[model samples]
Target: MDRIDVHQHLLPPGYRAALEANGVVAAGGRELPDWSPASAEQVMAGAGIGSAVLSISTPGTTFLSDPAQADQLARSVNDYAAELSAAAPRTFGFFATVPLPDVDAAAAEAVRALDTLHADGVVLLGNARGVYLGEEGQEALFRVLDERSAVAFVHPADLPGPAVPGVLPFAADFLLDTTRAAYLLVRNGIRQRFPNIKFVLSHGGGFVPYASHRMSLGIFTQTGRSPIEVLEELAGFYFDTALSSSAAALPTLLTFAEPGHVLYGSDWPFAPEPAVHYFDAGLAEFPGCDEATRDAIRRTNAAALFPRFGAVPAPVPEPPLLTRLRRRARTRIFRVIARAAGRR
Candidate 1:
């Protein structure tokens, strides 16, 4: 079916070293998968994926305290991904990872990654340090992305609170992170304001489809926005089928998500090869998933978001004046910094 896996993870050599040295072993409560380009290719081929958008999943470089170290590691990972993309333009593309909480550095890196390296999109951890998405400090970075109409791939991270004794974080906590980020984006008006940026929620939007009305009503009351208005905003997210292509997940997602918003994702490495087969089998055998729906999930929907993969680019509407102004100011500042760095 020529599938595009939009939610794959890539662990670079330096990234792995940093995680281990920092005493990090698992993400979302499961052991990290053994990963390599060769192994990823084998898995993709088995699952019939034609291309994969790579990213670093939860517990990203934010584990490192020093902004210097985090910044360097982000660049290294993005550069490594760029090299892979250059080698095989058709098989691989990557979402650039940035160290958050340091919003300026992240904004700058977003520019370099999207404008210069041609990254497919940017991967943002659901919560950065302790600052979740749609909070005060995130404006600058989100503004840059809104300007570019970038694809913001939201991945789960370990929650800020201490883990409970029994439940795996990925199994439960990760879903909350995704839900929180999505709701907060709607609450802060970030989703409404940044009409151009396509926000992709991983793991079928993490209980969003099933609980959207619950979220929207609460948000509408809190923000004093009309219920239907808030409902549209809540429904605006793009969802990926990563660890979420089961008979259970797909039906709800297919029913709720807007047409052309659901994309294929094989949460690789973290999901391992065997797990990939299991979910792919489920998706293939989903009785409700007809050829049209299956094909849209596999490729067409993603192609709408990412034009390089064959789908026509959706026309971007003009940004409002405030967004335009913010974009211009950020771009000028970014240029000055770039020139200063080059001089050094």
Candidate 2:
């Protein structure tokens, strides 16, 4: 047990039922994954993950048409996560889920989660009902998050409008969705205005690290703000390497992220176990990461963010020979599937 995974997900029974009741059988173009606490623990143990900051993945509360229902579900999932973290304080931390697009309810839920539930942070979708963060009607929520200086984990939801036929949102649209939120947050001055809120962008901030300059230039041309300033603000966000830790992607993320800003993430359950191992191995094998840098990305950086997990005693070491063989075989199969899916 060494690394602190900041981007893991929790799929509580109640949460899953809610989605099913709402006719959402899938998210990001994939079927809902089976998840249980025991299964999550087993995966973490095998991967040498000391703790995981659990969060609800995308299509958050916005899936529900009724605001009251959305808020109720958010509260239920947050309570469930708090209980799990309480049961094993060293093994778990959680980001609270909030009912968004309804700003008042969102603010109240965020306040409750931070002040009462004691969540490490809140998980926010890139867009809620087509309203991206930093857009109008979202100020109250930001103010609450800012006041508490919460770690808001921004996850991507489905892209607005009908999906392109045969293309999955997770394959390419998720990146653009996250980039949209990042750009709007900078352009609308949310990052500057609410400087206390630590925004952790998921999937290595979508395409932000790679296309930042182009985005900044677009912002510069529209508003009088400097491109350099936009880039600086975008770079200020914390990035988690979930499924984005390939050799090609990792270097760009490391280059764009500031010291102590990169954190580990294994998007379990939603990301199949083999895919998790594949990306984890990719992170481990990248040549640019020296021992110290790897340590920071794996553990120290996240420990600094959630200090309670920093001192957890090491668990049993991962088994080597069998695990390596399994990882290699499964990773190859996952790579082929990912390539066919057109994921980068």
The best candidate in terms of lDDT:
2
Model 1 misplacement above 4 A: 311-344
Residues 27-87 of candidate 2: C-alpha lDDT, one tens digit per residue = 8999999999999999999999989999999888898889999999999999999999999
Q: For each candidate in the order shown, give its overall lDDT on alpha carbons.
A: 0.84, 0.87
Least accurate 10 contiguous residues by lDDT in model 1: 313-322
lDDT of 1 by residue, 1-344 (tens): 37889999998887888899999888888886788899889888888999999999877779889998899989999999999989988889999998887899999999999999999989998898878988866888989999999999999888898999998898889999999999889998898788888999999999898897678668755876655566556667999998899988887787666667889998988887888889888888999777777777888888887778786745433434554575467446545544564476
Taking the candidates one at a time, how many backbone clashes does each contain? 1, 0
| Backbone clash total, candidate 2 | 0
Q: List the candidates' TM-scores in order.
A: 0.89, 0.89
